[model samples]
Target: MRSRLFDAAGVACVLALLYLERHLAPVPILVIGTAMALCLLLRRAYPVPVAAAVYGLAVVQVAVRPAVRMVDVCVLIAMYSVVKYHRRLLWGIVAGGGAAAGVLIAALVEWRSDTGSFWTVFSVVGAVTATVWASAYSVRTRRLYIASLEEERDQLARLMAADERAAIARELHDVIAHSLSVMIVQADGAAYVVQTSPAEARQALDTIAATGRAALTDMRRVLAVLRGPSAVVEERRRPRLADLAESGLALRIEGSAGELGAAEELTVFRIVQESMTNTLRHAGAGASLLVRLERSDGTLAITATDDGPGSVAGAEGHGLIGMRERVAMHGGTFAAGPVDGGGWQVRATIPVSG
Candidate 1:
């Protein structure tokens, strides 16, 4: 809209200048001048074509009258618009050079009749044309630079949003998958022994209720973080090596515990939790799982091995992928596969600064 208004004002000024000099120029020159002035309306939309037409009309006007007229100044406006709107600098330079050459040649043609030196007229016209072209090129370069910066900012925002979503997914998966696996196992056991053994059945039911409550609390904490950084979040204890006892996995420690950050602790907890859950789902009854943690030489090595004849080929799911992603976040190495003899093992090594 602003370009349209600006072009309209330019055409109005050129028409007024042509009217003031109407008596000096013949009817043919006046008609050509009016046509050239009106062409500025489409200059931005069709810069190259409009520029070519305007320069072509200027040559016709010169052939009609050898001396420069007031209406001839409109060609400079066309020059500025062409360079500002066009992306190719080579084209702008070529068009600007052509127009400048035309001005110099026209001034030379009238040198004998008019009382001015051809060099003086050429110098002034060339300087004005160079200044207008330089200004237009500068504006175009700055506009492109700003556009590139905006594109880079948008790409960074998308990457950050994707990372946030992945983090949320990992947290939810670890919480829900582990809790549900435990509840399902306990519920099945309670159903099997409800009539024969009342005490064991009641104990299983109690464990399910406790596990459900803990899962709800963990989910609430995750949701609170999602709500916003400013939202009130209750502090809860992070998981540790000792927590594996609740999952019925035997634990062994080879070295003293090293100081770890909160994120590292949660990563360790989730890794073991997922491994134990996989074993429980895939291994049949009477299977045994042993988890070992060895910390030494600025590194912590974790290995979970289960002695079960069941093949883990059918147990590959998002739980295993989530564990791998969690370990990667800490710059750790993880692997899970069937053992050489007849078992499955999940192992990971995490770096520490102890």
Candidate 2:
């Protein structure tokens, strides 16, 4: 619709000018000016083709008529359209060159008649054509640059969303996997001793209930993160290493983690929890495991050794991989393999700041 309005205005202006100067080759003026005006309708849709057609008629007009024509202004409009709409550099250079050449031809013809100064005509026409082309090229460059920035912003948003999902998965795995392992162990022991030992069975049942409540609380905290900041939810504190004692796992630690950052403490807690969970699920009955954490030289080192008949081959489960990723996020090193003598050992080292 905008193109139609521009075309109508261009046609009206061209016809009006030809009417005032109808005395100088009225037939050629009417024909060429009308063609140029009509071509403006397709300028945006077919910029290069319209530019080529307009310049072709301009060359013919310059030859037949010696003086500058008002219809000649359409050549600058066509040059602008070519560079503004098309992304190709070759088309813009071709259009600008064609306009310049036409301007020089008209100026030369006027100079020969001694009626107009050639330099004056060439300078004014060349400046206007060059200005139009340069302005269009500038607009095109800025538009493309903004588009690329928007694309980059969208890609970064997608990457952030993916990382958020992976974090959620890791949290769920740590919470559910650890709690279920404890409950399963307790339930199995209860089943084995329920007939002969009622007091021991009752203790196992109580432990199961406590483990379920802790798991439920941890699950709620994890879910709250997905509900957005507007949701009224209390943030859970980082898990302490001492909390694992209630889980009945034979674990040991040798250093004070009081100075560790909240993130580092949580990472440490999840690593040990996942290791204990793996030990419970993979190791057979009567298997024993020990976990040790030591701080020295501005670093915290973690080790978990289990005297279970577990092999190192293909031991990289989702839980262990998650533990490795957690440690790596803090610029830490992690390794898991079979011990030289027996069982499996998982070790990690994380840097700390005082």
Candidate 3:
């Protein structure tokens, strides 16, 4: 709507200019000028057609009219509109044709008029034509640059969103896999000794319930983060090295509990959880797992060793792959292999820098 209003205003200005110069030009010149000026009304919407009409009128006026009128300026505006909105190749052709026609008209008018010099008339026409075309071409280049920037921004946004989704998937996999492994083991143990050891079976049931509740809480936290700004997301407590001991795992920390970014902390916690879960799943009941965290020289080192009959070669699951990806994301190194004489071990070293 705004553009249309601007085009209307341009057309009105041209018409007024033509009316003021009506007496100076002949009837044929006046008619051609009026047609060319009116064509500006459709310049933006139909730039090529308006340009063609203006150029045709210019040719007719040059052939018949004795002198140029103020309305002749509308040709430059039409040329500008064509260059601004049309394709580059088309604009190039129009600009070339307009320049050539302008030179021819200047030569013919100079010959017809006995007063003005040829160079003066030609210089004015060439200058106006070049100025309008150059201005429009610059504007076109700027618009294209801006559009390319917008496209790049959108692409970057999509990539970031995909990265975020992958992170969420890794978190969910760790939470669900660990909790389910514990619950399943506890359930099986309870079923086997229900009659012989009623108290032990009841304790196993309680453990399963607690694991389920913890898994549910973690899942809700993850979902809240994914649901966007409208949802009131709460900061949930993330697991630390101490959490391993609290969970009754045979875990020990051997370094200062250095401060870590939220992302690094979450990655460490999930790696530990998944490792312990895998140990429980493969090592069966009465198995012991050991976790160690060490901070030194701006690097965090994590090692998990389990006294379970596990093979690193056989540990080809999504959980292990997720751990490797997390380590790699922070430019860290990861290794998982069987110990010299016994169980399996997983180790990762992550750099901590801004």
Candidate 4:
């Protein structure tokens, strides 16, 4: 409220200057001076309003006292303020042109009665026009600078997000691949003990326990991604399909799983592990699982199909969705659905660079 009061007080001072000058017969010097001051002060908050008022006052001064030299400065100062603060061409155009036209017409009318010289008229008009053009140029330059900064800021933000996602993806793959492989190995060993080795099945349970502990450690790192990355999680190394086949996932390698980057390798291994786990869970007593890896062109394709208890909710579950995201991180294509004859099929084609 106090700030507004001061602004009003300042406006009143401008009016007071005009009134005093009118009585003293000192021309429009005080009037134009005060107009310039108001334009400078109010440009940011009230660009259009201030520009309108300044140009209007110039017109009024030209009408009342045709020989006034003070109006030029007010128009010039106001035009600059509008350009710098408002950063708009329209306001600058209106204010600048208004000042030049009003002064030129006034000088033409007051030619014989006042100084009656081309130099005086041209000088005043030239000053107003030049000031307005300079203001417009300044506004254009400032707007360009602002746009450039915003573009750069957006680019930096995207790069940071990509780096963080890469880190998080690595952590997820490590945890999931390690845990599921250990579980399959344990489940397979337990199967052999159902007859005379019941005590050995108890040992398999301990392996599951160890795998679960490792999973929990990785889960902490995965959850940290959601909280925002303050520190980089260390990369994890896990057994590949070839290394893990002994765990009884029945890993059948048709081609190379590739010595690609860690992130890509992790994605392929997780897809295989996830598909296999789903098979073991839903494929009844005698479900046959087939894991195939083939290299086609510059891509490695992994296809896991199971003659399970028919499809195993392939498309409607989180397993499928997670697999797709893992594949997509490397700009790959992932597809999973029911095969033609009552089975589940999950396929992923990830890029490789030799």
Candidate 5:
């Protein structure tokens, strides 16, 4: 509603100027105003072309019969509208606007029959040129600032998306890593007991059932996070290297646990777990996983390998991407590939600031 009122005012000013130019009282002015108003209707959609047409018409008028009356009030307004809305070639628009104003003002003053002095002409040119340039400069600065703000907002949105993906990856690790480890341990225990002790094998079966249910519950909780707030998402605990090595995973360490910060230790632990989990998933049930953590000088080297069917290729998923991101976060070198003869091997050389 307010925009319509502004356009109506512009139309009224244009009609008043046209009336004075023709000395046609009000009738001819109303006709020209209505015609120009049609251009205004589509100005937003085609600002540059509409403004160009208006300026072109004025240039023709100045060439034929230059007068104070034909100085073009509507043309200046249209040019300003083009710069404000069109948002292209700002430097060119400013230069064009300044040039047009200067030319029109000089022509009007020079051609006026009852003109005064050259100083009067210069004064008008200087004043009008200064005012138009100032207005154009202000518009250009505001547009540049708005563009910078929008770019900053886009960057912030990307950071938020990355954080959400990281949290989800952590949740998936907690669910799959512990489940695979416990299952492998139980299966090995049952196999050893099957020939020697049948009762012990039955006990291993019970452990397998319990581990499976726990894994299912972990998955359920993870999926629940996606639903509405009516559902609860429990806090999931992730399996680190220390937990597996201490537990029945039979992880072997080559060197002592060097003096390390909790954060660095956690990073090492996660790297080892992710490696072992990958082995269990792809390397088959009887895969032999060997873990080695060695610290020397100022670096920690953590490596894990499994002698199993992982000698062949399966698929690479989000797990590899997440592992790379985690290792890169703390400035570490990571390598994971197929061994020459058999199995899968992963190694990380991480810097430790003791």
Candidate 6:
């Protein structure tokens, strides 16, 4: 709506100026001025064609009448549209040709009259043409810069989303793998003693039921995080070191757990979960495992050691790789190797800033 009003105003101003200077001007001049004013209405839609028409009319006007009138302002407006809307190469060629034609016509009129300075006319027309084109080019460059910045922002958002999905995949793997290992162990024990030791077999069945329930709870929590922003899952479901005691593992927490960020806390939990799962799978039955979490001097440290046979080598398995990646993402150090006393150990230290 604002643009339509401005175009109407421009046409009115040009027509009024032409009439004020009409005195003894030819009918052709009035018709040409009106045609050029109408062309301004289509400047934004068809800038090149409108600019060509304006320049052609300008040449005719200069040839017929040597005196300048306010209608000439239309030439600047047309040229500004050409540069602002059209590509630079095409606008450059068209503008250059039109400027040359305008200058030539003006020079001819001044020479024929033999009363005005040719350089003064040339300089004035050249400066106005240069000023309008420069202004339009500046605006075009700024718009292009803003478009590039928007494109870059969109690309960054996509990368962050991909990273989030990968993290969720790792968490799901840790939860399922650990729960299934414990269930499988208990099921095997129950099958072997079902007839010979009824009481023991019944105890194994109870353990299996408890492990299944815990697995379902943890699975739901992980899935909730994947349901996007609308999900109302608890913000933090961190597992404490004392939780390991129920699984027949020694628990030791040093200093304080302190206040860790969400990502850091999740990373710590997954590392410990994966470590325990490996111990349950490869360590011998009745093995002793020690789980520890400590915070000191702006760093949080985690260690899991098992007193089982040193059979679980630190290979590039998916579980180990996921644990390493999680720790590295938080700028932490991670290591896993066989301990001196014939056992496997996994340790990591993550920096935590308040």
Best by lDDT: 2
CA RMSD of all predictions: 5.1, 4.9, 2.7, 7.1, 6.7, 3.7
Model 2 C-alpha RMSD vs. true structure (Å) is: 4.9
- Runs of candidate 1 with Cα error greater than 4 angstroms are 1-78, 87-98, 105-115, 131-135, 220-228, 231-245, 248-256, 286-288, 340-342
Clash totals, every prediction = 0, 0, 0, 0, 0, 0
TM-score of each: 0.70, 0.74, 0.88, 0.64, 0.58, 0.80
On residues 36-97, what C-alpha lDDT tens digit does candidate 1 reach at each position?
99998898988888888888998988887777878887788888877888878777887788
Q: Which residues of candidate 2, in runs, are more than 4 Å off?
A: 1-74, 101-115, 223-227, 231-237, 310-313
Per residue, candidate 2 scores C-alpha lDDT tens digits across 87-154 of: 78789888888878887887897789897898987787778777888998998888889989999999
Cα lDDT of model 4 overall?
0.67
lDDT of 5: 0.65
lDDT of 6 by residue, 26-47 (tens): 7888888889899999998898
Superior candidate under lDDT, 2 versus 6: 2
Give the range of the ten consecutive residues with the poorest summed lDDT in model 1: 248-257
Error of 1 at 180 (Å): 1.8
**Which stretches of candidate 5 lie above 4 Å from their native place?**
1-26, 33-38, 56-71, 90-106, 115-126, 152-156, 159-178, 188-198, 214-269, 275-354
TM-score attained by model 5: 0.58
- Specify the highest-TM-score model's number: 3
Q: How does residue 78 of candidate 6 score in lDDT?
A: 85
lDDT of 5 by residue, 1-354 (tens): 777777777777666666665563344434544455456655656767777666655555445454444335555566566666666767336545655674555555574655644567657755665566568658867988999999999999999868866766685775576577777777888999899999978877777777677667756766666664556435344334555543334456566548777557767766666666676667766666787778888888877787876553444555565566667877988888888778888888888887
Sort by lDDT, best first: what order?
Answer: 2, 1, 3, 6, 4, 5
Candidate 4 residues 1-354, lDDT tens each? 675666566556655655655654444556555665566467557867886777777666666666555334556656655665665567666666665676576567657566666668768667756866685677668788999999999999999989777667655755575478568767787887857788778777766776677577657757765765463244233436654453444445566765777677777877877777677667654565687888768898888898875656445556666788778888999888778877788889999877
